[model samples]
Target: MNEADALDLVQFAIWTVLIASGPAVVVAMVVGVGIALVQALTQVQEITLTFVPKIVAILLTVALSGPFVGSQISSFTTVIFQRVQDGF
Candidate 1:
């Protein structure tokens, strides 16, 4: 493949990865911030306070978003395979 085609493929791969992981990352960030705020307000400066909620939230997000993420990855993979078949 030419340089442009290779770059396009790399960009697509990165975008697909970002899309697939976005929900979990967002959930984790939100949960972490919320927990940190609570800790600050309540004066409970326990570092461990952040982990459980973040983990749970990320897990829930993954569970809820699993099908969508899977479909996105599957479609990207299909496109990549098709591009290979097309000799791009």
Candidate 2:
């Protein structure tokens, strides 16, 4: 592949990674923020307070979004293979 083609692939790879990880990451971030807020209000400044909720939420989100993430990765793989076959 040429430089432009390589760059396109890199861009696509980034997008694929973002799409695959988006749900879990977003859920984790939201859960962390919520926990922080609760801790702030209640004066409970426990560092461990954020871990369980974030992990559980991230797990649930990943489980729920498995198909979407799988499909995105599959599509990206197909595109890559198609480009290879086409000698692009």
| Root-mean-square deviation per candidate | 0.9, 0.9
Question: For each candidate, what is the lDDT?
Answer: 0.91, 0.93
lDDT of 2 by residue, 1-88 (tens): 8999999999999999998998988898889889999998999988788898898898899889999999999999999999999999
Colliding pairs, model 2: none
lDDT (10s digit) by residue, model 1, range 1-88: 9999999989999999999999999888888888888998999988788887888888889999999999999999999999989988
Taking the candidates one at a time, how many backbone clashes does each contain? 0, 0
> Which parts of model 2 are misplaced by more than 4 Å?
none
lDDT for 82 (candidate 1):
98
What TM-score does each of the candidates earn? Answer: 0.94, 0.94
